[model samples]
Target: MDTITTYLDSLFASLPDNDKTRQAKADMLANMRDYYRDLLREGKSEEAAIGAVISAFGSIDELRADLGMPAQATATTTQSDPTDAEEEADEDAITETELRSFWHMADQFATQIALGVLLCAVSIALPAYTGGGRWEGFGVIGMFLLAALAVGLFIWGGTVFSQQKKQLNDRPITASAKQLANKTTGEYTRQFAAGLIAGIMICIGSLIPPIISAYIPGFIIENAGGALFLAIAGLGSYLIIYVSINYSQLKRYAYATTAANSTAWYHDGTDDDAANYWEQPHKHHQNTRARQDIALFHQVYWPTVLIIYLLVSFLLHGWAYSWLIFIIGGVMQNIITAVIARRDYSE
Candidate 1:
């Protein structure tokens, strides 16, 4: 439905906004929706139905004449004598430098968040390593102290990142990294793959210490195993979160089209693949909606998981592999988001 609306917007963009035009536009949209539903009833795929609707839209120029409006000016005339308004719009478009400076900080922000989480995990182990009895109090105090420091890092990093996003914002991403940086799409894809593999490996390995400790038969084995598991799991999470968050934003910009974002640094018409160009606007819409939904989930989910983790780790005296809770939570979050996105956008 959004894709249909977006296409309708493009078809009517040049027309004046008034009572008759609005009525016509609404009628056109209704007709398009009816055709779309008929195609669906005939078992056509959503993509095929949308394509058919757009292909049959014919010429907006004819509609303009019917609406008592003048025909569009020739491209040659507009190109030869572009208006001041057009020049001002071009000037107002976001610069690549501003984009690079602002968006490239995702990695930094991810690192800060991951490191803070890792520190909290490490803080849990301090009490175990410091021994039992009265000395455990000191270790517990140290745990809180480290946790406090980790919280401070989180606050500071989040503040800076939020402020940057709020202040440096402009148009959405409009071009691939090739237009802004030296890296290619293949490079980023490879990087994402490598990071994913590494995170999985680390997470898998985190199970090793606890498994071995179970058979070793020693008192400290449990605490040591738990500490090791937490640390390793935290490290794995850092890699996954760091790469996923940064790569997500990077990708949104990389494949964005001029129709999706106003800041088209180097979009000339024939350069981009025709199919890719047509897909961009819809992809942009899907990504924006999915990102918002996932972000809202993150706000509630991760903090709650952290609180649960802290209570469990503290109460259980460093339960071996307790930190696996985090890894599992992340996996669940990913699966949930993936399912939601597929179900929501599949139509």
Candidate 2:
């Protein structure tokens, strides 16, 4: 019993500095130690006590199960080929983890794309709807509302950025878990900053077209307001593009982190059964392929679309068409960019 307790203590001492894993190990060790000590207090000889402890404790696989890890084997009374059962269990559990990681990757992709589309829609629609000069008081109210919303978003994004940064800076990325933690922190911070800056710029740029129209000559001002609106709209569109690009890049890193964390946890928990999971070896290759695919799409498709849209709008010589085309193109561009962005990390 004393020997068993000493063995568990040594194993616990060798575990890496992961808070949840460490606490779990500590609790399991303490429980085993107490149980064995109680056995020693009975009239058993040390050899008998140690044998009893070994039989009851089983192996690391049993300890993992006792600690509430997902059971790797079915409870079959026929103790035939327990080794095969362990392999099957490992395969099942690792597949579940991989599926979870895949779903999480999809979620991360959808979120960034949705946000980008929303930003484009809001930026384009706000100026066009308010440009007609009919809703005077309502326009002022809407501007304030938009400003408030932008500020609120910025504050939330900034908070996430700061927290992630602190977590990253405090830790050393010397292991797989630490590396994942740092990568996640960096990605979150980048996305938050991109969204924050883009939102503020769009809000401010949207207001410029209306304000400048009230000050110039009627002939000069008519075209001036529309031209200035288009210019600011173009700038806002560019900002959305920038945000989408950065968001796509950041989301890729986030996927890598999630995959790494899952792999690390699997390796840490599974003693000899870790070889069954395919996540660790394939992760890097998958992410690299994803990045290359995204880059190819971005480089080949986006610029051609943007150029054609701009050229057609210029040749048409109608303000309404120009405005409509710009708005539609901007929104479409953002959506396309967002979709491709997820592929950046898919490799």
Candidate 3:
């Protein structure tokens, strides 16, 4: 009964915690307990009784609706077959740490993309507003202000990423699980075509300002430049949104084997059977090292780049060219990464 309660808790843990939700969960749990006990009195084994009780318990969506809660896509899914439903229920179980990791990734990408757009827009707007009396020196001040904000946001995002990694690593997944199947090549190809079409639409939408400017004259061209900056930012935001949506969709593909069935007790004794279920050799080591190296590079590289941009902008008073340093740094980082990967692969 304790194990069953724990399992139910895991299922609902991702939802928002509140009084009504809590009471609804408690009610459902009590009903399940009653059903479980009834099955036990019918002369069933403990395992079968528990399984039957769980199987009889319906989807949480209807319950959530009755509780006046919004529909949640992350809620436990259902299947027609009892066995498959049980398997899916077990697989979809996720810890709060795992959910936090997904949210962090989404938030980091969104923040970074917004910052990129803001920096680009300010770069355009500052120069356009500079020739006036009141704003003569404001360009430099505004640029520095935006740069500081960007740095703070970058640091916060980095911290979130670090916290997510630490939390996930500290609590390892020991559940003996069946690895979920990846999407087929055909599915990926279809998605790629759809994404490309979406990207084209985004580009077309972004070019609307320039298209409009072509019909107008004079000072409007400068306005068109600002529009272009916005368009670039929009494009970036679009890509991030696309990536995040895809990531969320992909999460459904991964299912974890429940702890209750991590290992088969009736398996024939063998040396190979003693190996840990989650263990992978070379690929695991390589992936871990890759993630660590990438994280380290981002932590060091961005802060160093931000510092250099600030120094150059303030000392040389070259706001126009100083931003190019970021582009150059990005290219260099890619080159260095490629070279290191090649060297590592060779060894």
Superposition-based RMSD of candidate 3 using all C-alpha atoms, in angstroms? 18.2
Ranking by TM-score: 1, 3, 2
Give lDDT tens digits, candidate 3, residues 1-347: 98779878975786678765566567667656765675576588999987866655544553343333443212342113334433433343433335445554755655574465456556555545564556657766776776677667667766765665454342222232223213322344466446545644664465555556676656357554554645454454445344433443233222222222222121122223212211222222333444456677778988999999999999999574465566446535644654554443332
- Summarize candidate 1's per-residue lDDT along 13-104 as a digit string, tens digits: 98778765677677667667866786686689999999977775545664553344443323332243222323323343444565677666
Overall lDDT per candidate, in order of appearance? 0.64, 0.47, 0.49
Minimum summed lDDT over a 10-residue window in model 3 is located at 274-283
- Top model by lDDT, which number? 1
What does candidate 3 score on TM? 0.39
RMSD of 2: 17.9
Writing each residue's lDDT as its tens digit, candidate 2 over 169-198 gives: 211111233244346547566665676467
Model 2 per-residue lDDT at 197: 69
Worst 10 residues of 2 by lDDT: 169-178
Alpha-carbon deviation at 20 in model 1, angstroms: 27
